[model samples]
Target: MNFDEQTVLVTGAGRGLGTSIARAFAHQGARVVVNYRASAVSAEQLAAEIGGLAVQADITVAEEMDALFTAAEQHFGTTVTTVVNNALADFSFNGDARSKADSISWEQFDAQFQGTVRGALTTTQRALPGMRTAGFGRIINVGTNLFQNPVVPYHDYTASKAALLSLTRTLAADLGVDGITVNMVSGGLLRTTDASAATPEAVFDLIAASTPLQRVVTPAEFADALLFFASPWSRSVTGQNLVVDGGLVKD
Candidate 1:
């Protein structure tokens, strides 16, 4: 996990899981670009603390994504060796039961899909060339294990993550020849994050008791799977989804 001189660009790095991932890369000695759509203050604070650069960009916008990469090259004087797509629309953080397939509106589904799939697609498209030139790259998409076993009805979110896994596999097939590997790490419900704050304590307790680890995974624990995909150890692996749900979704 030592990335002494590598440069990594992480989206949605202002807080939560993104922030933790950024810190992990920095801890491994990689120069990191912390990208955020808003929350300039927190993003900047994280960048300063990690000795990284904070670049503001809306992942759904191609121009802004281009600017983020340009700034990364300008600051680090090298192409980014790793790109982690962790950004998504600022939707309801709570995993409240949403629309059912029969009742869900197209707009709701589209809004989530655009952020998860389209945003990741565009960002990777922009970064692939640089990755090709460098002859190495790691592209890890943050996914959720909820899609595999949907205990809660998060129609839009679950659909988008499933789509993301498809994108990951396809991209890996298209880019593996160039040394750019695409992969995904899907995790079960996490505690304390805004996304999980609304989950009922009783439900959390039930799942934890049933799960092999007997607890929800933390952001740090989830990030460890991401790090494995980015590390040299996974060089031969690509287009695969690794479940980090403490055996909750064991295949």
Candidate 2:
């Protein structure tokens, strides 16, 4: 997709899937804003490599998120027309380390909600006015298939993503009048992202065998689905979740 006329803000884009998403947008000609919370070095490197602006902001903090948007506009001389909410709480995808419901605490769930749900809320609010004024916008929330098939019982992570999906639909309904579309791209067990680096090779083999395509999805492959949501072809599509997991879970 050609994003020559658009500016994109990708959260948690210092590495992992965020890195792939940022690079994809830049490759497509978008003035990209790479937002990172703590991965400053990596984020800056990726931004420099892609010719994007590397901005640091903790998505859970409204003030910081606002600053990120401000920085994006100043650097690109244009409002961010697209946002990819890809920032994830620091996590190690080790199924063995995950807390089962019996051992999980509310604090764990709260942390996930703050990062996954509230963060999206804050960024959407900041970007709304600009989108409304321009009558064009695209909000793509990253999600996962764990909610559909909690194979590993990652209750906290799955719950947060489920909440994000709720916001995606509701926001789409409320923002469509302004030509802003809200959608989600859900994937399952990305091959080797920072968060998923701990996943055992056996788990990957298991998931790959279960999917019709017989392979775990890649971050770049998942990013294309997000781009479609922002592209003109999906102008009329909103409040929908597109699963891009090599057909692991059909919805």
Candidate 3:
């Protein structure tokens, strides 16, 4: 389907990478729904700037997620045809602060699971009916390259994202028959996002030096990959994880 005809919902879109993703879709002429668990002020500003809608909803909660979709449909007068599972629990990319393999707790793992896997699950389930009815849909889950590289070995975060990738492929397999496509966009340490803001300057330099592109990937760059998945150009490209880390992890 054309982007102009699609209603795109981006979770956690009030700030950070979600903000960039929302703007990118809006620039493409899509009716964007900026979903945020918090950051209402920033979200509302973004929505106004793009002439889109801003709705608050915690993606892990089914009831709130349902409301989110309902609000989008009511405002746009069309069901959401694209979903970007970009919301994550509060997290920082500071290697020194992360729990090591021997010290990580199950609670930490569970928390990440709730945000990463469960959030995606709820959003996907809620969006399926509309997508099936339209005979076209795009489900793009934001992931991390750490699953393949494990540069910092963020055990909890990496593990949960790995599971998200698994879910991405499995959903693509199951939903393909219904004319819905599911995929993932995995990125390395982004230049400047809320999650990556905790990263020290040296770490960013180190990552930039390691990648073939010789620079850290920007949130805008990562978000552009998401557009491909939602656009007709990628109709046949489902169940794949496109790594946008400038050749940092060539999987």
Candidate 4:
């Protein structure tokens, strides 16, 4: 779990919170692999800045996921030891524009499911052989606190993340013998990520007031939890969901 010796792959790391998570891993001396489905310019820029590799792959596609790991391993001369499932489907956290319960379509839920659950599944499966061979791996899934708080009831997003949490646990049980750990880091609405940029100022103020920290969590702050799950500090922890919402959701 020494990040200095780890090659970390972060899905959807071209922008937003994923970018912060990628930077955090690189800062800790991990050989970071910035995986992007789009936003190539930003991804490449980030990779250059951090001295990491930027690989483009749609996490939901098995072929792409396979290529992603292959490219990373070939570039770094090592397999990825840490995998961060941080990519989200195209979504805007605009409560006003969201589909209501009565009007919500199954397609909406399915889209999120493909992005959150399926994406993680593909990436994990692709990364397994390397992890098994090395006998050390970290699968850190990105999740949401809405499952516990449901403040805005983002039905599709919350539900998909809920499914991801389930996957996180089951994978932990199945992979522990191989020396791999799976965990989740869930966060409330972040201050100003691209997805959260659509959130009204008033809503952000309200959420900040509700938290014990009296401020919305930043992407960088939420990213710190990802490090713990991937580091030696969390060696004994697996299949656990750590909520980092500035105390917005006590659970």
Candidate 5:
């Protein structure tokens, strides 16, 4: 896929999946804005490696989010056509799975949702104006396949992803007329730098065994699905969730 001169903003690109996604776009010739909250060093290194711009901002805060877009416009000339909402707070790998729903506090759930869903909401809203002005936009939200099969019962994380899927479909309907397409790419049990560290080897083996492809998906693999949605080939597609879980949740 030749992005050529297109600009894509990837949030949380300091490391792991977000980094991979940013690099993928950069490799395809799209000017990428690598967004990070605290991992400035890593973000800068990646930006240098890919010849992209690194912007720092906490998406949960409105002011910081505004700064993020401002920097992107300054670097890319005010016409960002793609956004990949890959930023999420430190919710996964918290090791806080209690059997009973009563054990899950409201604060825990809210924090999880606020980081993932709320952050995506704010980032997308901030980018909508530029996207509308450009008359072409692709909004890809990174989600988890845990919603299909909650083996470990991460209530807060799972619930937030479900909400994100719903948000994707709704946004696709609302934004289609504006030449903006909203979609999601859901992955299962990806072994990464920080997110899925707590997952045990046996659990991974079992999931891989169950999957038709007999393997867990990687960040790069999932990024391919995200690229498809962002490319012109998917211009007619929107409001869809493409699961890249090796056939683990094919229902």
Candidate 6:
């Protein structure tokens, strides 16, 4: 919980889960970099409130990520040692509108992968030099529980997150020698994130009723699991997927 010397960068931190994660890191005394692809206003406002830097960078684009880091280091007076890959593709959580496996296009799947897997890879790669030089780093990827349960069968979204989990483990193995720990935090349908806003109230109620906790997880609740990864307490933990869906997946 003490992140005094860490410089944290959170992607898509303009709103929702990303916003919550960034806030948590800032509150814990980490010099936070709020990276936003859009939502400039919200991102800037949050940065001002938390005393962090707001930078615009599309994680999918390498050049933009470079600029983001350069700007962050210049502004924060240090390189980023902690990264939270929480950016998500622009997709509404309307189960009724989601495409079936047979009807889903490869392009749709690719887009999700670009946001979840590729974006994480790009950010991780960019942060490596800084982390390597500092001899410490924390890479926490935000993921979904759909891959384990697949209750809604969001083929494209679920497939992309599965790929992300694979990357998380490999990166953990590769970076362990460099004092960097890579891990994932997976959550089920959150109570009310921008992505989940389109989900029906009845659907949310049904999901809550099915879970042992009788409630959907909150962004803040899932974000705390992410903090465990970045904190010194999890010094020996890596390459693991921690599900934060109120025991819905049991992983």
* Regions of candidate 5 where Cα sits further than 4 Å from its true position: 94-100
Per-residue accuracy of model 2 over 96-187 as CA lDDT, tens digit each: 88998788999999999998998889888999988887889999999999899887989899999999999999999999988899999999
Task: Estimate, for each residue in 105-199, the C-alpha lDDT of model 5 and write its tens digit.
Answer: 88878988998888999999988998898888899999888888886788888899899999999999999999999999998888664777766
lDDT of 1 by residue, 87-200 (tens): 877665454565667888989989999999999998998998898898898999999887889877788888999999999999999998999899999988876565577677
Taken over the whole model, the C-alpha lDDT of each candidate is 0.87, 0.90, 0.95, 0.94, 0.86, 0.92
- Pick the winner on lDDT between candidates 1 and 5: 1
lDDT per residue for candidate 6 within 1-251, as digits (tens), equals 25989999999999999999998988898999999988999999999999999999989999999999999999988989999999998888899999987799999999999999899999999999999999999999988899999889999999999999999999999999999999999999998899999999999999899889999999999888898999989999999999999888875
TM-score of 6: 0.98
lDDT of 4 by residue, 93-125 (tens): 999999999999999999999999999999999
Ranking by lDDT: 3, 4, 6, 2, 1, 5
**Model 3, which residues run further than 4 Å from truth?**
none
TM-score per candidate, in order?
0.96, 0.98, 0.99, 0.99, 0.95, 0.98
**Candidate 6, superposed: residue stretches over 4 Å from native:** none
List runs of model 1 lying over 4 Å from the truth.
Answer: 93-97
Worst lDDT 10-window in candidate 1: 90-99
